[model samples]
Structure formats: structure tokens, C-alpha cells
Target: MAEVRPAFDEAARTHPPLREASSARQDAHPRQIRDDDLAYGLERVLDGLAARLEA
Candidate 1:
């Protein structure tokens, strides 16, 4: 947990510029939530539930 912020900042600095997104992309998600973000979040939640059930 202590190293997470530094690691994230390092990755952000080192990563290459991303490709341009569409206008709808900007309008729909001003907060920078990309396409499929909901699906990805749902998958993560489901994984956590499965792990808890198994435990």
C-alpha cells in the first residue's frame, strides 16, 4: 500500500501518449471513465465475491 502511489505516478510518467478518443467518449465520460469500465468493475466485484465465497 505504501508503494502504490509512487508506482502509479511512475507508470503515468513513463507510459506513452494514448490515441485520441471520440467526441462522444469525452461527452459521456468527463471524469475519464473509458469504455467497458463498468464491465471491468463488475468483473472485479464478481471476482471478489467468488473469492469471499471460496474463503
Candidate 2:
């Protein structure tokens, strides 16, 4: 919306640095995603489909 951009910009400028918002602790494990996680994810397609779909 035309009214949203300036409001977002104002809040963004006032927001804290990103690191302060997230992890400050040591991790025992690293994050990961399997290969099939996206090859067949929230939305998938048929090679011969006539239309697209959304979740």
C-alpha cells in the first residue's frame, strides 16, 4: 500500500542491530536442510500440469 512504505522505513531506521535480536550462545549443532526439502516442498509441480497451484 502507498501508506505502508514510509511507515516501514521509519520503524526500520529505529530498529536495533540484527545481532542483538538473535543468538548469543554457543551451539552444539549446526542448522541444515535435506535435499528433498525443496525438491518436494510446500509447493510442488507436475512436469505436465496445465496450471500452477499455491499452498
**What TM-score fits each model?**
0.39, 0.24
What are the per-residue Cα lDDT tens digits for candidate 2 across 1-55?
3465456456656565633332221121223233435555534555325254432
Candidate 2 segments whose C-alpha is farther than 4 A from its true place: 16-55
lDDT of each: 0.57, 0.41
Best by the lDDT measure: 1
TM-score of 1: 0.39
- What tens digits encode model 1's per-residue C-alpha lDDT throughout 1-55? 3445456446656453521333224335434465477778999999999999999
Residue pairs clashing, model 1 = none
After TM-score superposition, the amount by which residue 19's alpha carbon in candidate 1 deviates from its true location, in angstroms, is 9.5
lDDT of 2: 0.41
Sequence-dependent TM-score of model 2: 0.24
